[model samples]
Target: MTSRSSWNTRNSDVAWAKFDPIAYVDHNYRCIQEDDAEILRIVRDHFADHFRTTDTTGPVSGIDVGSGPNLYPALAMLPWCEEITLLEYSPANVRYLEGQVMSYDANWDQFWDVLREHEAYRSLGMGPRDRFCRAVEVKEGDLFDLARHEGR
Candidate 1:
C-alpha cells in the first residue's frame, strides 16, 4: 500500500476545516461525564504535582496541541500557566476558539466546577470563563509540522 503521507499530501485543514466546532461542543462538552471528570482529575493532579516542584523565575507558558473544541485541557492548565496557546488545524475550530476567548459560552462552567475539586484549580478563584478567556489565545497550526522538529 502507498504510504499514508503520499495519499494525504494536501493541507490537513482540507478535511478538518469542515468540522463543526459548536456541534462538537454540544455533543461532547455540554456536560462533564464521569470519564471526563476522572481524566480531568488525573491531568489536573499531574500538572499540579509537576508544576508545584518546577523551579520558575517568572510566569510559565503552555501549549495544548490539537486543542480542537476542548476547553477542559486549557482549564486544567489554567492555574499553572500565564498564557496558554490552543493550537488547532481546523479553520472552523480556530474561529470557534477565538470567539470563545472573546466571550466564553456559559456551558463551560460545569467543566470548571469539576476541575475546582482540586485545590490548585480552586485557588484561581471564581469566574473561570473570564480568567480562561484572558489567558488563552487561539492559533491555527499543524501538529505534524511541529513534530518534524522533535529534537534539536
Candidate 2:
C-alpha cells in the first residue's frame, strides 16, 4: 500500500480554499443535523462537569491545535478557559475563522445552545457570538514546529 504521507506530499498545493471560500464554508460548517447537536451536547456535558467546581475567573488558556475552520471545539472550552488560541496552518482557514468570529453562520447557534446550558458559561456573562469572538485568537503556524523536544 502507498503511504498517505507520500501521496499528500505530491498533492499538497491543491487550492481547496482558493477555489471558493463560501462554498467551502457551505460544505463543511453550514450543515448542522441532529447528530451534530447530540455530539455537541456530549462534549458540553463532559466539559461542564469537568469545570464545574473549578474557578473560572482565573486566566485559563487553551490551544486548539490544527483547528481546521472548526469553532465548536473552542466553544467547548469556554466553560473554563478564558482565552483560546486557535493555531492553524491554512491562511484561508484563518480568514474563515476570523469571519466566523465577527459573524457566525446560523448553524453555530445550536452548538451555542448546548454551551449556554452550562451555568459556568452563564456566570461568565458570555452570551453568544461576540463573547466567543472575544475569547478566540487566531495564529498561523504548523503543528510540527510546536513539538516540545530538542530534535522535534
Candidate 3:
C-alpha cells in the first residue's frame, strides 16, 4: 500500500485542484464537533489577549508554524493580527492551505459563524472573509526560516 506521504506527493496536483476550504472546514468540524467550541474559545481568547497590548497599528505579523490541514488557528488569529504567514513544508499541505484561501466554494458564512460567536474573535472584525483578507499571506516554507529572519 502506498504511504500517505507518497500518495499525497503523487496526487498533489489533482488533490489541490479539487480542494475546497468549506468542505475542509466541514470535515474538520464534524471530526471535532465535540471539541470545536472549546478549542475555538481558547484560541480566540489567547490571541485576543496577546494582540491587545501588542502593536497592531504597524503591520503585526505572525507565523503559523507546522500548519497542516488545519486552518483554525490561523483563521482565529486573523482578527487581531495584521498579517499571518503560514509555513508548511509539505507541498501537499501547502497546496491544501492555498486552496482554502484562494478557491473555497461555499460562502464564508459558516467559518465566520465560529469566529463571530467567540468573544475575542467577535470583537476582531465583522466576519470571517473580512478578517481573513485583511492581512493574510501563505508561503511554502518552515519555522526555521521565520526564526532566521527574526534574528536578522
How does each model score on TM-score? Answer: 0.82, 0.74, 0.64
lDDT tens digits, residues 1-152, model 3? 87887766643343443445446656775344637657776777676677766765666667787676676677777766677877776677777677777544353444546666756766654556656665667787755566667652
**Which 10-residue span in candidate 1 carries the lowest summed lDDT?**
5-14
Query: Whose TM-score is higher: candidate 1's or candidate 3's?
Result: 1
Worst 10 residues of 3 by lDDT: 10-19
Between candidates 1 and 2, the lDDT winner = 1
Query: What are the runs in model 2 whose C-alpha is more than 4 Å off?
Result: 1-21, 53-57, 148-152
Score residue 111 of candidate 1 by CA lDDT.
78
Weakest 10 consecutive residues of candidate 2 by summed lDDT: 10-19
**Residue 23 CA displacement from its true place in model 2, Å:** 3.1
lDDT string for model 1 (56-141, tens) is 78887888999999888898888878899999999889988888896677877787887888888888865677788789988898
Q: Candidate 3: where is the Cα deviation over 4 Å?
A: 1-31, 53-57, 103-111, 123-126
Clashing pairs in 3: none
Compose the digit string of candidate 2's lDDT tens values, residues 1-152.
98987687633465534545467557866776677678887888777776765556658888898787788888888656768988877788888777877667787776777667767667766466767777889888777678763452
**Candidate that beats the other on TM-score, 1 or 2, i.e. the better one:** 1
- Candidate order, TM-score descending: 1, 2, 3
Model 3 error, position 152 (Å):
7.9
lDDT of 1 at 42: 87
